[model samples]
Target: MKNKVLLLTWSALITVVLLASLSFARQGTGLIGNVFSDFNDFSWQLDEFYDIVGPTKLNSIDVEEAKKNITVSDDEIERHRYRYGTLADQLSNIHDQYAQRIADAKDAGNELLMNTLIEERDMKLADIRKNFESDAHVEAKIRKEKEKALVQYLNDVKANSFSLPVAYEFTDVETGETYSSGDVSVPAVYKKQFNAAKGYFKANSLPGHNGTNGWIRTSDYGNQAASEDIQITTSVKTFEGTVIVPKSAVAKGGVLYSQYKDFNKGRLATYVFWLLGIIALITLLTVMKFQKEWVTGTAIADWYADLKIDLKAAAFFMTALILVGYIDSKSSNLSNFFTYQSLGRWGEWLTSFLIGGVVMTTLFAFQLVNGVERWKREGVLAKDIKNSFTLQFFKALREMFLKRSIGVQSFILLIGFFLAGIGFIGGFIDGIFLMIYAFCVLFLGLPALYIFVRRSAYLNRIIVATEQMASGRLNEDIKIEGRSPLADHAKNLNNLREGVRISMTEQAKSERLKTELITNVSHDLRTPLTSIITYTDLLKDENITSEERAKYVDILDKKSQRLKTLIEDLFEVSKMASGNLELNKQRVDLTQLLQQALAEHANQISESGLDFRTTIPEEMLIAHVDGQRWWRVLDNLIVNAVKYSLPGTRVYVTLRKVGDSAEFVVKNITKFELSENVDELFERFKRADTSRHTDGSGLGLAIAQSIVDMHQGNMKIELDGDLFKVTVTVPTK
Candidate 1:
């Protein structure tokens, strides 16, 4: 229930965020408006100023005469500063100085001084004019002076201090003669009249000269030559108009309009309201579904957590979308309405939300289903849920799948259908159809394939079981369930299991019988041998009287000794079979040890009437073994060979180093049946002949095999009819 509530909350939050982003995208344009307003204000001010100043007019004679007579040097021009210094004052000083020079010249009658003074004054004037014409500061200064002069002229014109001239002399460039001709000459008269009109200008400065309409003064003389015509070419002052409009009004093409032509303003409010309604509807539906699922006990905590995470992701995406859309709407290059349209944009948001939600939910559901299936298949009991790790995991998984199943499936299907429709309409009908076909194949065919695969796997398991039964091993229990042919085969496997059990029981019984028979025989032989040894000891007393008694005593001693040897051999064989014998291992130099052993048996070898051939290396061949037991093994093999070997034939005792082990071999020509398998000669009481004619107790090889085993070595016998050979291999450390 808690999980369901959380999921609903997450869904609601994501929807709100996406809707808010779309709303913001539609309405935001403050930056665009501010930029346009600033530009329009600047342009409007410039236009108004241009209208007030009008155009400048220059007299042809004045311009032509000024161009021809004005000559200024580079140094003089550079030194001129019309903007910073007082022009009126400087001009007055020049005029006064020139006047004084003229007075002095006239008084003394010095023409040279006066001429020089006049030339200097002309140069100064030419310099000032050039500076004012080219320098921006000087141009600005001239404009300021013209504004002042224009105001004075306007005042003079208003006061009637200036008379309008009809005609004046216009100079001819070639002859320098005056002519009263056409309107060209009339412009010259207007120039003179404008100069004369300065009489009224000297009285007062006009208002509005620094502000808008101030250029009216310059415009009043329609045909008059402007003062400082080259300098005061244009007005610098600008006039501004107050704009009155609603705050909502947007500007377009330098004009503000009450309504936006691009966006459907009338429908915008309705659309926003409708979007809100839709969001609310979705929220309500989601909440109700959550409540329903919760009541039905299907809500999962993990699903709820995933839903919350997905909601946060959606929120982030919506925020980025809103920011980008807002920026796009404010940009000048792209259309605002096209950039901010909510229908297509919201559709995309919805699609993304559905896709993300479905994916998360589906993943969670799959994990849950898999876990639950594993637990159920393993036969985990419900009662052990608290104790079993598997049970708890399955429970958690089940809850996750059940709670989110419907919501996840619905979301996926909706998104899938929406994408399909979009693709179909986007000239991809074939792709849409293909997607549908693939989905069908995956959804329906996959389950069928799963069922078939499962059936095959079950059959394969049964076949494997049957094959195991066919082999010797049938101990495994076949616990397969069902009434199929494979199940019946499994039953047959169980029957095989019972049969194997019975056979193993019978084999165990036979092994026990064999062990009992050997134990009883050995014990019985020991008892009789004990009696004979006791009798032989009694008979060895000095009280025995004659040769017959001596003979009887000899027989008794021989029988006793033979019986003792037989009993000891039986005991040794039994101990070996039971694995009770032990070897005391030490590092023994095989060459030295073999020499010592051969020396101990040297007298016996000589007395046996057989030629004993001993070949061994002088170099030390070390082996890790029981020295005493290994010596005894060699002793038994050589003695047995000498006993059975044909008299007067050679007996060979050869020892050699083979890899990491030493091989000791004793071969002799013997008169024994060699038909028996040589390897089986190591078994207890295994003899070549049924009759006990040989002196050996038939346990020599068995004892040797046991001793070798204890030393972690190997012993074997090889027979070639009357030529028999025994070999013992002891490992070196």
Candidate 2:
């Protein structure tokens, strides 16, 4: 609250004071006064006075009214006194001259002459005393003298004014050479008339003398009067302002001009005041709002965080400042400075530099603070930077310069700007651009070039890696470098290479498994066929015993049955894998199916010497699937558990609803040690036992997994220690 009041008070004080100053200036006698006085003109001051006190005040200042309060200046009084004193002396001289003339007449020894001379001398002396003794008489005398001068001046003007332009000539005292009539020189008194006479010579070809004295005719005048010279004479008149008008009126003209000058200045000051008042109000309101944090945090603030200060920008700013200062320092040309007794141009430069330096330093301090704050705040929320300018610089260098593409283009464009700068600007600007070019080449160029070249090298590696992969050699890993796009591409390429290698490895494994499957099936089928063939051959032999014949027939039937089952299992597994098996999907109780399968496998479980550990939930776990296929899945899992569980080892079968899915898990300890390669057990002719000893076909788990997949269920196998666990999850909805 106090601070707010203080701000308002300060603002009010400043505004009031400035307003007062502004009013004073606008009255046209403050700032304007100083400016006018610089040129020795106080006209604006008079203007201010007249504007304040209008023509009414001027009209009020009558001569009689002015005389009542006005005192004459010393120069005027002294001049008038000298004039009065000289008149008194002139009166005394007149007296003395009259007395001398009186004495001369008296000395002629004629009574009449002496009386007449004495009378004339007395009359003239009295007249002189009367004229010189009183100011009125003196003023009248001056008026008469002016009247005489005016008349004489008019007469001279009349004499100089020719009826028509006529040639005139004058003799040259030094050279008596005949000269062109207009070319002849004259006294300053007759120069005007002489110039007027020039048109006559130029207008007419004839030279002759006119009837007027010294007026020569142009017709034959130059030829006939070649040796003749005419004399030139005239009187010239000059006048003063005081002679044509009252001293007061002439002074008033000056006053009026001054008034107008003040009016213009007042207009200018008015504009300044209006702008100042507006700015003051805005500043106050802005400050109040800013103090309240009304608009503190914004996009600009965030952008400020990304702002960075550049030394080159500062240097350019200073360079511009120096140029402006130089221009200002040279405000007065060298010639003027020297001729007008001012400071030397160098001295002016020094002074202006100091002043400009002070102003620029203040501005620079503000800018530097802002720049530093921005630089500091840029990485405030960021990592890999420790809030030091140096750290930030290096970070930027690593990210923008050393890395590649994204920032390398900026460097390229910057170089291009300078390279193209010569076309846009010439002279000093071109030179400066050249300097920038050299600077960039020396500093930024080497690093940028390295980045680009390194980027190119990475690209080449990627290309080569791609070509190798295209040619079926995809085992190589592409080297990853910077965090640039090219590096990302390299990483992707490396992943692709690994993927391709895995794919190719899988392909080779599949081929090997395919060969093994063919070989194993051939051997298994041939063993049964060979038995059948031998039995049939034995049956064909009539010499064999009856029991032997019966045994051969049973053997043939058993081998045929085994061959048919294996072929059927293979076809079912193939159909399931090829996605050709369709399901009559419906919501089925997974728990019930699991229990039923467990019950059916109970006899096998009992015979196999494997204990059953069942945890089938009664809460009715349901799954959307083919009820028959789901039963088969349970039957297969149970059968496999019964077959694979070691004697006295428990097989766990659990059915539960987890979230929206039904999970059925079967876990067992294998009777035959389960191979680590459990996935191969799902392939045809592959089993835990590499030797064809297990009676069950290897397609049991494979068909179950395929049925689960057809129902959009997940089947997972986990092997831990001597335990194998298979989990199947089917969606309920």
Candidate 3:
């Protein structure tokens, strides 16, 4: 508690000192103009004061006296006469002006108006001709106009000279007489102490009439009449009295003056420096203490960290705004020192700065303690931004743009929809707009209607196709046109139709296989059982020799064993079909396994009069499989090859690595034609010997296929006329 109190006290004190320094820098009169003694000066202030007071001695010109001396030359008079252009062009201009008006009036049957316009044109032309013929009359007319213009110019000059509250005393150097305007008794403080004359003057030359030629020349008459020219040269007057402004003029209403006064006379600069020095020392001590205690132990830091993410973010944003506004306000106030304006409220500015400084320091400390830690504990800045509502809205809007086809189509349709609606309404508003409605219908509405009809027809076709597929007719595929949503749906329906067709075909094949399985099982199992029964009945006939009885007993024994073998094979095959067969798997050399299978069938291969050709890689090809199950697969293929190969034909058994898998292939010419579907050879109780005369269960290939499937291996049978081939592939370790 003590540490917390001490830290807060020290921090608040630091904030106050910092804010005071900022305020001093920002306030125009506080630092640059007042506290900074080197920059403080009074000369500029005196100059500005004199400007406010304005010039004292005013000059006037006598236009009548000056005009009497203005003489117009004959050449100048001639020039002025034709100033409007040649007489012929002048008459033409007048005619051009009234010709259109006169014709329009005549066309309207207003003869009086037309005659009036013709008379005006004729009078203007007559004046132009008269000026062209007479020179003296033109010269007199030009002189009168020059006199009138000079009088107006002088009158304007006098009207524009502003009267001031200033007093002036002028003494004539020759007469020793004094002329005064106002009181002419200003004090020494407000006097404009300057060596130069400060007043308006009259000249023999006219204002802006100095040129000898061109339209800008107001008059050259003064240049010609040199003798009568009354040149009013500037005269010097000796002024004895000092000009002064009353103290009221430089009071509160005149902020610049007051500020200058404070700038010159105020002596608080040393005190301000000492205060800042002391504050700096205190800040150093405070910083040293803070380095030891930091903000982690502060209750405020804890409270800030405990705030909800949104509330904390708002606090951070508002703090930033306040700091920015405070800095901008201070910077603008500081700039005002160089400008001539009212000084800001120093006390109010200081107070606001202090408050803002405290808030800034508090939030900065809190941010140091909690902000980075919180972000690391929660999520990164990207995650936070991605979760923001504004970003999410923009992300969704970006996705809308990313789907360009849909967005473009939707945008075009929306425009067409609105345009068509507007056109429909416009048709009722005006007859001319009826064309717009028709144009929109032909260009926008008709195309949209056609697309809708086409899509609807396509949808109807899809529906019909689906109905046909439901009724088990899946031959036809729905036609897909464009990359539209409807087309995608149609594609999906096509795939579903293919899937359904395959499912139905598999169902029919399963039914036929089930019937064949029952028939084959009945024939194979009953044959052995019947032979055993017949031999047993023969042994039961006692009227026979011992040798005959023994032979009969041997026959019964052989038939019973065959029956047992058939039943065992049937149970094993059934177990494999039901997916209940378990195998002990291990890494076995497939080359060696194949060699062992072929070696076991060597006797049969030789007895069948078939040449057995074995090909295997010398290097070990290892595979992860159940040793006994894999051996069974190999044994079945070799046995079938030896049994079914045509007499004196070559049976090829090859084992080699193909990429990442081991391929064991067996090819031979079958002794019998495999006219049926080659896929049906893997069925139980089905074999190349259609007569069921071979002393073997027909479950060899079916069991082999089941075992290969369980081990995630592949077994394929290919038949070409009398040629039979089997390929078994399995992944090698």
Badly placed stretches (over 4 Å) of model 1 are 1-564
User: 1 or 2: which has the higher TM-score?
Assistant: 2
lDDT of 3 at 158: 50
C-alpha lDDT of all candidate models, in order: 0.55, 0.57, 0.68
What are the per-residue Cα lDDT tens digits for candidate 1 across 1-733? 4755555455444444444444445534432333332333334543442222222111111223322332333443344463335667666767777887778887898888878888998887666655656766444443454455544553453443211112222332333444342243211201322122332111112222332222233234441333233222222321121112222334343123322333334235434544664676677567534332322234343443233333434544565555445334322222333324578866864565444433333333333443344346554433334444555667775764563643454455556657656655654556767776567547854565575566578868877777786786676777777765556767877887788778888899869756854764565466557767776776778787787577767777776777778779877777877888776788888888778877887887788899989899878888888888888787778777766777899989899988988899998887566665665566565555445555566677778888888888888788877888888888786
lDDT for each residue of candidate 3 in 229-288, tens digit (9 for 90 to 100)? 222222222333345444444456752355545544333543454366477657757653
> Which numbered prediction scores highest in TM-score against the true structure?
3
Residue 455 CA displacement from its true place in model 3, Å: 13
How far residue 49's Cα lies from its native spot in candidate 2, in Å, is: 76
Candidate 3, pairs of clashing residues: 186-244
Give the number of the best model, judged by lDDT: 3
TM-score of each: 0.33, 0.36, 0.37
lDDT ranking, best first: 3, 2, 1
lDDT of 2: 0.57
Report, for all candidates in order, the number of backbone clashes.
0, 8, 1
